[model samples]
Target: MRARKTTMLALTAGALTAGLAAGVAAPATATTSVLVKPGKARPGQNVTLQVPECETDGFATSDAFAGSAALDGAEEVEGRAGLATIGAHTPPGTYQILAHCGDVNAVGQIVVLPGTAPSPRPTPHGAADAGFGGGAGGVNVVLLGAGGVLLAGAAVARSRRRDDVTA
Candidate 1:
């Protein structure tokens, strides 16, 4: 009986090892490819990343920007791809965009151009010539006062109607 028990244990161990080896020998089935459009953009521009060979149902992908910003989107279908918007304040430089599909990963680079300088705002017309107290808080105060008067008038009318009905 002791010998039989030992043999059974050894057979079980051997079977488990064989099963693990078979699993390891099998090739992985998850394959993917990634692509990016226009490869270069400026801050505030939209960048599209395509994963043509992703899973049919969907897969999660992420974009790593300048090694700091990380954006994630899903690949819903074969042709449909992920998208990430370059931040408006992203500095002008070369940045990387990474797309991950299961164990496969792809990377692309983007060059951001320095945006044009903002035009200086023209000085407003003379304060008296401008509307609403030179675009200050005067208009807001006047509107608030008018609203308060209308509310008070409504309350007075409602109270008078109630008093007449009661009488």
Candidate 2:
């Protein structure tokens, strides 16, 4: 009976070790996450989404988005990439963005800054007016003014000293 009990204990220990080994050898499950380009955006701006775990296609939806953005998994550059535009009148605040890719789902956040977006600047037609290229070298107006004031103070002190000596 004692021998039988010892054998049973040994067998249980061996089975546990084998199970652990198999678990360690098994392939790790894929981790899925949705990435939002320019995580923070202004209203009416477009944002890019990338979800590598999506096997075929995905869609990103958010209250801030103008509409649901379709994602294509076929693109090699950005996996399951898509573009979603922020609504023009979306209120300023943090909004949750959800991406659905087949059975997988991921979540991300986008912040809408308060105030309207500035209009896009028109492309320049020709060379910019560089003003003789002098503006490129930064000038400290405060430092220049301080130096002038110091020079004036020194001149006044020197004149006072000369007057004293003459007297």
Candidate 3:
């Protein structure tokens, strides 16, 4: 009986530790290079260039660009992003996109698919207007903690009940 209780306590501690560790969120790593959304795009389609490592306003150059797209507004590193329109006349091929920050340079590419016609550019809107983050990528720490506590409590209660019956 003594050995059984000891084993149960050890198992409970292990379970609780594992649960807490799982609940703890990992730190986000900053991007050190440019990232292009929609790696494959049709001509005249707008592609977003993300330069999370950039500190100042910059621009992106590409043969596919209507012209060089300006990366401006919000000097914060994470906020460094811009829109580059794929030229209607850009040939169907993979084009290298080079983004230039203050002193940082990052490269990415966009592939223009063949045969898509250019459409009118839609009005740009704020991210909030997109209504994103609908409770996505969230960890329910409070619920997890509560569940762990309840599990530990139940284990202790069952062990005590066994003791009471034996006594």
Predicted model with the maximum lDDT: 2
lDDT of 1 by residue, 1-167 (tens): 99999999999999999999998997555444456666776666666667665443233333324223222445454543755666667777776655555445555676766783244478876445445444533457678799899999999999999999999
By TM-score rank, best first, the candidates go: 2, 3, 1
Measured against the true structure, the TM-scores of the candidates, in listed sequence, are 0.39, 0.52, 0.49
Model 3: lowest-lDDT 10 consecutive positions: 128-137
Clashing pairs in 3: none
Tell me the tens digit of each residue's lDDT in model 2 across 43-129.
988888888777768788999999999988654655688999889999999998888877677788889887666777898775565
C-alpha lDDT values of all predictions: 0.61, 0.83, 0.81
Window of ten residues with lowest summed lDDT in model 1: 62-71
Worst 10 residues of 2 by lDDT: 127-136
How many collisions between residues are there in candidate 3? 0
Q: Which tens-of-lDDT digit does each residue in 1-167 have in candidate 3?
A: 99999999999999999988876754333335668888888887889888877778889999999999888766543747899988988889999888887767778889999877566679866444333454444567787799899999999999999999999
- Runs of candidate 3 with Cα error greater than 4 angstroms are 1-32, 75-79, 117-167
Report the Cα lDDT for candidate 2. 0.83
Looking at model 3, residue 44 earns an lDDT score of 76
